[model samples]
Target: MRGIQLQLSQTQKVRLQKALEQLESLSSKVNSDASVTIADSIPVNHEDGVLKGHGTTDLNGEVVATLCGVVERVNKLVYVRSLRSRYKPEVGDIVIGRVVEVAQKRWRLDINYSQNAYLMLSAMNMPDGVQRRRTALDELNMRCIFEEMDVICAEVRGFQHDGLHLQARSQKYGKLSTGQLLTVPPYLVKRQKQHFHHLEQYGIDLIIGCNGFIWVGEHVEARDDMVEDQVNQTDPQVLIPNKDSVSFEEQEKNYTALETRKYICRAANAVRVLSSLGFIITLEIIKGVFELSLSSNLDIHDMLGSEFCVLVAEKEAERRSSNKKKR
Candidate 1:
């Protein structure tokens, strides 16, 4: 759905069509009857008892899907996995979000979820790496840390009385900078062990947030609170600078390096291609495409071209096939 809006030659169109067909073929073989639309009755072994799970319901003793997507069964439980929907945060899932509002004691973030997520002041670790309680002065300085429209990375911390709550207790989970934020459909991002990656080769960082907000930019070292002894503790007064006094020189420091910026664009375009093809996103696949572009000497700007896209599709088909054979 991403680059297809561009003008295409007949040959390019044909290649894209073929690649899409191949993807459908592979998906169908995995579970021909597993894909279903809304209100479709799920096929089941009738002799045994069954339990309806999320995205499913019983209608006259028949199991039916309430959503449109693949059906999965685990033991006696059956459920539908929606292919397109707002982000549903699981506790502990890493999410990248934007500051939407600065409320009384918390910051509201738009995390692509059904509701805006809350980041209470009490849930955060002090910038000075102190373990003491957050004082009223700390609450007053919240805007200095994260203002409206600023991007942030955080962890899901279950629901509070008002809405979904997020936490940034660790160093890595905090404000994001020098990055390009891109949004893909939520279904394409699958949860895994790690969501943060530092691409040392390209000097870039990639955070594939579970809510589908991706950050591509120059890598920054995750701040270590344990190393506070090496440097003097930052004075609260100095830490909370007046917004009006912020200088141009300080802001210029946030600008990324030329080479790192190029890498960021290339990586972002790679993600665009994968999302357009509806492929499950993973580090291996993403890195494969990045290396493919570099090895072929393809210009960074040309990575999103129709010809390059077709090449990527063909390579992906071959790669998945090889993986299956190994398995």
Candidate 2:
């Protein structure tokens, strides 16, 4: 939706309108009563000792919603889960952020939270994967590891006295490259066990950040480079040179394939359409849209057209209706 601006014909507009109506109808049947807006009163029995949670306030004697969201009840506790709001971080959640500042012993990242998250140098593993004390040399070379405006992926390490702390002890967590980052509403992305996806067919990696940042990039196998270095050092006969010494032109030869780049654009467009339609974002659904576009023989750029948007709405409506019937 951020980059898509379509000019639709009259017929396209009518079809899109009808499809959206059907989608709204299907959604209403599932959660019509559960959804609430700001200042809406929540029904609760006072005799049971109700506890008000986030997004709810006591208005005289009634429990009124302080924000527009869905009312959630957990035993005696009640709260409103906001449908659209800034990201609220929790411990152990994976997030993608951009480096905003490089301070002493740490780098501050903009993680789409109330404040920028902090990534302490000591918390992350060194490039050599050797667990040693962070010396003064390490502090001086901090910019070499991460400079300003570099996009990185890390895990939330809980709040400290200064602010939110992050860690990147694993090989999977580090600076991301050769990728396009898309931002959506945090609520659209639901937390799951696996957020990192490697679509083998498309030859790309997808990272659905819990903080509403989605990254589509070329896949790099997760391996410890230090292991390879250790092997080189142990074997005197091995003539393999250091990867860091590779010439820039040699690295350029490994650029992403043209077909893979097309697939990336298609995958990115699928996410854009789904987010614009207010549908829940998931790995399976994204792949579905992508495959549908391919099956229809639509060009990568045409996926952003009004007709495709209507088709996606209709497909989602049918899917939801069938799922409801199955239940």
Candidate 3:
């Protein structure tokens, strides 16, 4: 276990050490014998026709691991699940990434993968919500839609000859604003059916990217651009908007409530604490930590202190113990 560097008193150090030791003991009970290092031979029954899977290769008829990870066996099939590795893009996985480059009709993003993922203009829905073919005008105005360093949420389309591809066809999939982007170990984030979460109480959106790029931002309602465009086109008053109306609209767009910002920070801090403890990042776990902080009346900054880290470790150890008992 890696200890976080912090200026701690003797009591705090002892408490943290105890909590971490308890956590480690619980983890050892589950994965002690299953863990493997590179070049380690994986014992298997050859009489059952054992098949070698990812991270394992046949070395003179012996199954040897190519990576350091935990060995997982699903019946006869076995593979090593790396503890820390780059994001492996799969079709239909949701990912949050920053726009690194805007080329001719496509955008390149660094998704913490071995290679940059590509988001082609033709693969995504346009701002107008039209299904027409992309034109030269659209290609020229690509930067206006997504410039350099703009954070975006997209779905993995698949791998092509060029590289990994992404698509943003839904309103929920687009540029993220007014939030903090946190990068954690990719293995900490597991794939789930629902990655996009709107905390109505906090008035924020939590996007858990499978790629370990999490976005915690102010929640924006999904709007149908096609319907909105039709309404504006038919309404003569909307076409010739008054100055007062335009100013109010701009103000509404630019303003972020102070309370919302506070919640965003609180939520972000919860993630930081969880990541620092090397806990699995999940929505339920995040909500539990956030609510615990609120109940304890801990300031956002104080959540990063040694006491909170110890508290989290103890709570996690207790939670896992109870869960194992139930099982």
- Using TM-score as the measure, the top candidate is 2
> Which lDDT tens digits does candidate 1 get at residues 1-327?
454655678987887778777767776888777898888999887677777888988888788888988998899888898877778889999999999999988999999877889999888876777698777666666677778999989999998777799999999988887879999888889999999999999999999999999998889988843212312333545453355664789668667778888899989988988887677888888999999999999998888787888888888887877776798
Candidate-wise lDDT, in order: 0.83, 0.86, 0.86
Candidate 2 local Cα displacement, residue 41, angstroms: 3.0
What TM-score should be assigned to candidate 3?
A: 0.86
TM-scores, one per candidate: 0.87, 0.88, 0.86
Error of 1 at 54 (Å): 4.2
**Worst-scoring 10-residue span by lDDT in model 3:** 225-234
Q: What is the C-alpha RMSD of each candidate to the true structure, in Å?
A: 3.5, 4.3, 4.3
In the predicted model 1, the residue pairs found to clash are none
Tens-digit lDDT string for candidate 3 (69-95):
999999889899888877888999999
Report lDDT (Cα) of residue 57, candidate 2. Answer: 93
Candidates arranged by TM-score, highest first:
2, 1, 3
Candidate 1 residue-pair clash tally: 0
**Cα-based lDDT at residue 4, candidate 1:** 67
lDDT of 2 by residue, 1-327 (tens): 333467878987787778778777887777889889989999999999999999999989999999888899999999998877778898989999999999999999998888999999999878787787887666766776788998999999999898899999999999888778998889889999999999998899999999999999888898543223333233444454544686788678658888888888889999999988777899989998999999999999999888898889778778877888899
lDDT of 1: 0.83
